[model samples]
Target: MREVPIRENSIRLGQLLKLADVVQNGSDVKELLASGEVLVNSEVELRRGRQLVRGDRVRVGVEELLVS
Candidate 1:
């Protein structure tokens, strides 16, 4: 289990991508997100602008990221 802290309760989808190391650049977040490779709470997430809050778990490949 890995944890990433959001400076504010409101974090953008692109920000979460970089924090999760799914993409090296924030600019590529949208592409990665559109690939339907990102999962939130075990469900496929396709929205790059999706809002995330605490207790949301994002999973990519074998990585499980916990937000709090």
Candidate 2:
């Protein structure tokens, strides 16, 4: 997994996805979520507004990102 740093204590899942370069845009994130390809920790996450704090893990396809 790769680390993606955030200035704030928490970040929205959609914003994190973009920051990590996991998706191209908000639309892409929506589609990806609908497809059930986005995971928080180990379970599927469909909420774009899901709050993520330090040490949270996000996985999409073959890419895994760690919030730091």
Candidate 3:
């Protein structure tokens, strides 16, 4: 469990991944999301730009990233 601080609750999900070091680049995050490898709040997330808030829990494969 880790925290990714944000000034606003309108941050994009893909950008959050970068902050959490889940993926190296935008393309990598995009690919992971597109391939149905990213889950948000328990369901698969295909939208890379999905809005994420501080309480949202995002999971990429075996890695779990929490928004803070």
C-alpha lDDT of all candidate models, in order: 0.82, 0.95, 0.86
| lDDT tens digits, residue span 1-68, model 2 | 99999999999999999998888999998999999998999999999999999999999989999999
lDDT per residue (tens digit) for residues 1-68 in model 3 = 67778987668988898888888998998788889988999999999889998789998888887788
* Residue 67, model 2, lDDT: 98
RMSD of 3: 1.1
Stretches off by above 4 angstroms in model 3 are none
Task: Score candidate 3 by TM-score against the native.
Answer: 0.89
TM-score of every prediction relative to native: 0.83, 0.96, 0.89
Q: Please state every model's RMSD to the true fold in angstroms.
A: 1.4, 0.6, 1.1
> After aligning candidate 2 to the native by TM-score, how far in Å is the CA of 34 from where it should be?
0.5
* lDDT score for residue 19 of model 1: 78
**Number of colliding residue pairs in each model:** 0, 0, 0
Ranking by TM-score: 2, 3, 1
Candidate number achieving the greatest TM-score relative to the actual structure: 2
- In the range 42-63, model 1's lDDT, one tens digit per residue, is 8999887788898998887788
